[model samples]
Target: MSVGSENLPQFALVGGKGTGKSSLLESLVGKDFLPRGATRAPLVLNLRKSDCQEQGIFLHRPGEKIHDFSRIREEIANRTVILAGLVRLSLDCQPDNFVEQTKSTIMEYISKEETIILAVTAEGLVMSQALEQAMMVDPEGARTIGVITKLDRAQDIAMAELDNKVVPLKWGHVGVVLRSEAVKCWKY
Candidate 1:
């Protein structure tokens, strides 16, 4: 069964490049459906609650396209679907960056009732800068939440920086230590 876009609450996951956005989504949706490489354009994962499966992915570039991946897990029946937001471009892109544009688009989709998760990695200072820019675009960050990925790779210095709250985020931080994988997914 397919759920219309209007009925669900959009839950976006915004962050800089290589912040483990796709990996987080795979963990949440309980499948390795989404591609971990750079997203070329915005895409919507059509998730259905009753079936506990990802029905299709609605790609937003080169016109809307749909792809089906059949993998169902019974454990997701009781859980609901919330839109996960991810930008198709890097936050540090030069010449013509799409971070601002993407944030604006996401702001339009989210209602006053929904929340947005900001994914940040503890490996660099760039994550903090990206968060600040996001806050500027969506002040109040009223419904924003921060997820700090790559806790396992954080060094003593990086851990100290995080502990000091060097870059203050309004919604607070939740650290996630992803298990080491053979592929070495993170790119900078």
Candidate 2:
């Protein structure tokens, strides 16, 4: 059964390229739901908990519900999917190179009172554009959750960041590490 868009809680994943936003979502779902490679547009995934053992994915358009995973990349790349449900919004990693249009778009979503912002950052990185934006919008960090990916590659600098010595968030931070190449899963 499908849940209505209005009923599901909204979560916006704001991170740069290669920050593992897609991977994080995939791991959470316990399946390879999103397509590989760079996400060109905002992909809204309506995740529903199922009682059955099997997992299913569907692409919802205006008049169609597609179950083929192979067509997902094309639909996203073509910007054909209707924007609804839980959205994963990706931003450029480099703050210096951040485009004004993208920044404005991100600002709009994060500023909303209902949207929960997932500020994702990678280990060994001092700062994240996503995190910086989230902090700017919500100074108290009440609705933002800091997700630190690639903990295996973390250095001493990362430890400081993790300890909240560098940047403190009211919600705090969670570190995740990729376990193995075969499994391609993260250990939180």
In every candidate, how many clashes are there? Answer: 3, 0
| Candidate 1 local lDDT, 72-182, one digit each (tens) | 221121111222234454444322545566666655554335446464555644346445545665656565555667766764534554442654456555556553553
Over 1-188, each residue of candidate 2 has an lDDT whose tens digit, in order, gives: 99866555567788887777877766666666465665545545454445643423443454344455445545665552333212234234434333555567778778877778889877532468888889888888888877787766664446666665466666666667643443232312
lDDT of 1 at 38: 52
lDDT of each candidate versus the true structure: 0.51, 0.62
The most accurate candidate by lDDT is 2
Q: What's the TM-score of every candidate structure? A: 0.58, 0.68
- The reply for model 2, stretches above 4 Å from the true place, is 1-8, 49-60, 68-70, 77-98, 124-126, 179-188
What would the TM-score be for candidate 1 when compared with the true structure?
Answer: 0.58
- 125 Cα displacement, candidate 2 (Å): 6.7
C-alpha lDDT (0 to 100) for residue 45 of candidate 2: 48
C-alpha-based local distance difference test score of model 2: 0.62
In model 2, state the lDDT of residue 96: 39
List runs of model 1 lying over 4 Å from the truth: 1-7, 51-54, 57-113, 122-129, 157-171, 179-188
In order, what is each prediction's RMSD in angstroms? 9.0, 6.6
